[model samples]
Target: MEVGFLGLGIMGKAMSMNLLKNGFKVTVWNRTLSKCNELVAHGASIGKTPAEVINKCKVTIAMLSDPAAALSVVLDKDGVLEQICGGKGYIDMSTVDPETSCKINEAITSKGGQFLEAPVSGSKQPAETGQLVILAAGDKALYEAAIPAFDILGKKSFFLGQVGNGAKMKLVVNMIMGSMMNAFSEGLTLADRSGLNPRDLLDVLDLGAIANPMFKGKGPAMLQNNYSPAFPLKHQQKDMRLALALGDENSVPMPVAAASNEAFKKARSMGLGDMDFSAVFETLKVLKHSS
Candidate 1:
């Protein structure tokens, strides 16, 4: 299969690389052209603009960082809208709000292009290993058409109903994830301050009903103060903020998510935004010691 991939950030790079490794011919684009070099070295072609990529491939997938970048690449000069036409499918797997996803969908469909919002759930390792879960919606035909590629990018893909469903599902998932991470950080910090080994806490948690891959994967790393950007703190905070807005739109209260957002904000204020979301551990640790 031949396809176009946009945005060569951490997630996008791994996803596009997987496509190449799986024997799909891939064309890539990034605002910073140099980011394309590594993928190019691995036999992927480059498109200087979003239009060029869309022009050359029947299916184009975008894994941009946020809503603004997502909009710019599709609405700006030489953007996707410039070349999108009937039978051309665009799958946006960026983690933006439902409204943003709908906006992109409307624009694409108006231009006779098929659109799908396909935000993903999973971090760097899952993305690298194609173990990510994909939440997809809009244009069921496009979802079915892109399955071959989605099969390569995600371990599971859910076809939600419409344009905004995928985005909402992604936000809800990330909100819960952020809340859990905050709770985990607090538990670890409390354990350490009480003269208990945080590692033991992790071990106990692992053997319990609440055990999850995230805790198992990130627990030891958090205890070691390893905050390398698997899923950056800033992005987590962004998802929290978006999810809170979603709650407001639905008249649902999300106090825990709100509290988690505050912790993420504090972490970002402490210059840990670029680190792993688990770096919230540092923020909690500091407050405990200061008290």
Candidate 2:
């Protein structure tokens, strides 16, 4: 099946490369034309716009940054809306609010287009390695049709059954992820301040039931102050903010998520916004010295 990919930022680039490597015909479009260079060189077709991508493929997946960008690519001139119609499938893998997903779903289905909100649960490595966990919802038929593509892109894919479910599921998962990162940051800094090697602490965590790939993977680099943008800190803050809004809308108490959101905001204020989300560890170091 011909696949169209919109957006070529960190996640999008990694993902489209995986699809191309797997022998899929992929047509890609990015806001910045230069961002498509690597993929274009790797035997992927280059699309001038979202509409062009949709026109060239039966299934088009977009990994946009946030709600506004998500909305823009679909609603703007030369957008997905222009080409979406019967027999076409649109999958959005962006982490956004449930309401936003619903809005997109409505727009696509109104024109007889199949829509699926398929947000992911992993960062750069997982995306590149095709190990992401996909939370998909919307049309079941579309989900079934996209399974071949999803299998190549993610380690697991869950069909959550409805337009908003996938979006809600993604937020809940990311909320916990953000909260855990905050706890991890605190533990790392506390260990350092107490004259214990944080690396040793990482070993201890790894030996316990709390062991997770995130800590094991991000730990060493974080200790070396390598805050590369696998997943930008600003985007993490955006997810935290959206997750908190989801909590408020549902009357669910989310104190931990709220606190984590503030920590992310503080990290952004420290000019770590463009760095990896792990840069929140930097914010922890700043707080340690400030106090």
Candidate 3:
């Protein structure tokens, strides 16, 4: 299958390369043309603009940073709308709010293009290994048409039945993830402040009922203060903000997610925005000293 891939950020780059490696003919584009070079060397074609990619492929998948970027790439000049016509499919795998997903859906379907919102779970390692879980919704036909590519990109894929459901699922998942990271940060800081061995704390957590891949994978490096950018802190904060907005619209109180969002905001303010979302641990550690 020939595929159009827009965005070449951490996730997009990994995903497109996986497609190319798996024998799919892929065309890629990025706002920064230089970012596409690595993929070009891997036997992928390059598109000069979003429209060009859309016009050239049966299915175009986008994994952008946020809702703004998602919308801009579609509605902006020389964007997807310019070339999305009947028989074309556009899948936005970016984490965004339901509203944004619906807007994109309406715009695309109105132009006779098929639209699907498919936001994924898992970060760098999962993306690279094709172990991410896909939460997809919108045109069922498009979802079916995309199965081959989705199978290559994710370990499992869910068809959630509507354009916005994928976005909602992704936000809820991210909200829980962000809040758990906050609580984990608090626990680590508390363990250290009380003269407990943080490594021992990780061991106990691993042995306990709450054992998870996230804690297991991120704990050791986090204790050593390795705040590398697998999933950047600022993007986590943005997801938190969007999740909170979803809560507000539904009259639901998300106090814990709100608190986690604040910690992320503080982390961003402290210049840790470009680091991994776990970098919020640094913020909690700083808060202890400030208090």
Report, for every candidate in turn, its global Cα lDDT versus the true structure: 0.95, 0.93, 0.95
Q: Each candidate's TM vs. the true structure? A: 0.99, 0.98, 0.99
Off by over 4 Å in 1: none
- Candidate 2 lDDT at 232 equals 94
RMSD of candidates 1 onward, in order: 0.7, 0.9, 0.8
Instruction: Please report, as a residue range, the 10-residue window in candidate 1 with the lowest summed lDDT.
Output: 280-289
Count backbone clashes in candidate 3: 0
- For candidate 2, lDDT tens digit of each residue in 140-224? 9999999999999999999989899999998888889889999999999989999999999999999999999899999999999
Write one digit per residue (lDDT tens) for candidate 3, span 169-197. Answer: 99999999999999999999999999999
C-alpha lDDT (0 to 100) for residue 153 of candidate 1? 87
